[model samples]
Target: MSPVSSFLWTYAVGVKVLLSQLLSRSFSLPVFPLQNGKVAIVTGGAKGIGYETAKHLSRLGMHVIIAGNHENQGELSVSRIVKETGNEKVEFMYLELASMQSIQQFVQHFKAKNLLLHVLVNNGYIRWPVNQCSPGAAAVMLVPQRNTADGFEEHFGVNYLGHFMLTHLLLDTLKQSGSHDLNSRIVTVSSATHYIGELNLNDLQSRHNYSPHGAYAQSKLALVLFSYQLQQRLAAEGSHVTSNVVDPGVVNTDLYKHTSWLFKLCKWLTSWLLFKTSTQGASTVIYAAVSPDLEGAGGSYYVNGQKVKSADISYDEDLQRKLWAQSCNLVGNPERHQCAS
Candidate 1:
C-alpha cells in the first residue's frame, strides 16, 4: 500500500469501530403514522437514504413528490415506492440541485398544482470535484476551478442554497398544510461532520481555500442554523411552520463512489466497520418528519431519534440572520409569501 493509504487506514480503523458502537447504542428509532391527504416533497429522493425515506413516507399514505436530479433514477424510485406502498400517489419531478434556475422552475411547476406541502425534505447533495465543462459540450478552454452556475462553491450551492431557495418559494404552501400547530415539518438532513465545522461568516463561500469535507460541513451547519432561525422567526411572527435538522449517522450509500482510490479503500473499511444500512441512516429523518415526540417541537437538531446538542457555532444568531438575508437574495425571494386568504 502507498504510505498515505497505509496511514489513513491505520488511523481510520479505530475511529470507525468507535463510531459504529456509539451509533448502535445512542438511541432507538421511532414510528409515526401518516395523515391522509397530506403531501410531501423529497429532494434527492431518487436513491440512497432519500429513496428509503420517501418509500417509508409513501407507505404511510402521504402523496409523495420525489424531486431529484436524475430523471431515470427518479422515475425508478417512484415506481418502486408505488409498488411497495401500493399508493399510486407517489410521483417524480426533475430538479437539477446544482442550478438556481432549475429550482425556480420546480417551484413554478408545483405552484401550478396549488396543493399544500405537508413536508419538505432538503436531502440532495454533490460530493466530488468537477471540471469546468463536459469534454464534449464545448471545445473552449477548460477551467479547472470548481463553481456552480449561481457562482457559489458547489457543495454549499447544491446542499444548502438550492434547498434554501426551494423552501422559500414553497413557504406559502407549507404554511397552508400546517406548521408547528398542526405538525408540518421542514427536515434538513445535516451530518455528524458539523462537529468539525465553524461557520466563518466572512467566508461563507470558502473562496480562498476549499476542502470538500470542509465545505460540506459548513453547508450542513448552515442548514442547522437556518432551521433554528426559521423556527424562531415563525414562532415570533405566529406562523405555524416548524423546522428541524437531523444527522443520518454513517450510512452505506453510493455517496462515496466518487472518492479517489485511497479514499475509496478507506470508505470500504469504514462501511464494513462503522456504517449503518441506508434505512437506519434515514431513521432520524423519518423521525423528524412524523414522530409524535416532534409534534410541537420546532428548531431542534436530532440524531438517532433523539434531541442532541448542536455545535456551539451553529447557534450564531447574527450569522444566521446574515445567512438568511444572503439566501433570500440568492434565491430571489425577498419577502416570504404567505398563502392567499
Candidate 2:
C-alpha cells in the first residue's frame, strides 16, 4: 500500500473501466417489450447513475419509483425524468437506507399501494472519507468509526443489509410479478473492488480493523454474495425471479464526494480521460434489468452488458452461504423459512 503502489492500482482500475466502456459501445441493447403496467423501483435514484437508470426504465413505459433519502432531489429527479421521457408514471418515494425503520416504512407504504414490483435495483451507496472533522471545527481527525441504526458497520448496513432487508420484504411481490411472465429481476450494483475484499466472518462489522476502503470493499463483496444466494433460492423454489449483479465501471459519481482533497485533485486531473459518464455507468445496470437475452439467467455477474468472471473468492459456495445466513441473522430474520437449511 505504498503511495506509488496505490497510484498504480488506481491507474489499472481506470484502464479496465475505460476498456469496458469502449467494448460496450460496439453492442446495442435489445429493446425491452412494452412495460406500461409494470412497476420498477430504483434506490439512490435522485442523482448520478441512479437517475440515469430511472430515466431509461421510465422511457420504456414502466411506472418507476425513485427512492432516496433527499426529498427535494428525489422529487426533482422524478420531475426531470417525467418531463424528459414524457412518461407520467415516474414518481418518487422517501427512503433512508441507514435506518431499518425507514426501510420497513417504505416497504409498508409500497405494499399498501398493492403494486406488483417487476424490478428492484439496489444502487444506493455511501463512502466515508479517510478523514473528517466535526461541523465548524478547525481541527481535522480520522473519521470516527460508526454503525447504522441496526448496529452494523455503516457501509455494510446501507450498501448490503438494507438492500437485503428490502429485497426480502418485497420477495412476495417480486414473485407475484414473475410468476406469470418470468421477467422479474433483482439487480444489485457491485464493484470491481470486491476482488480485493476478504470476508471476515468473525468481525462482520469490522469492529477491530476498520479502514474506509476495506469496509467499502467488504460491503460490495457482500452484495455480490447476496445476489448469487438470492438467485439460488429463487431457482430452488422454481420461481421465475432472476437476480444478477452489475459492475458499473468507474463512474464519476457522488460516491467520492467525501474523499480526501488529494484524491479529489487526482480524480479531477484524470476525469475526462478515465471516468465513465453517468449514462455509461448506468448502461450495465439497464442491461441486467431488462435484457431479453438474459431471460432465464441467474447468479451471474455482468460488466458492460456481458457476463464476466468475478474474483475467485466470489465463487466460493461456503462463503456465499455463510454470508447469507449471517445477513439474515443481522436483519433479525433468522427464523425466516427462506433462510432455513
Would you estimate the TM-scores of all the predictions? 0.85, 0.89
lDDT of 2 by residue, 195-312 (tens): 7666889988878756666666678888998898888888988887999999988787766654567667867887776678888788889888887778878899988778999978
- Please name the candidate that would achieve the greatest lDDT relative to the true structure: 2
Which 10-residue span in candidate 2 carries the lowest summed lDDT?
A: 133-142
Model 2 stretches with alpha carbons more than 4 Å out:
1-30, 126-144
> Cα RMSDs of all predictions?
5.9, 4.5
What number of clashing residue pairs does each candidate have, in the order they appear? 2, 0
RMSD of 1: 5.9
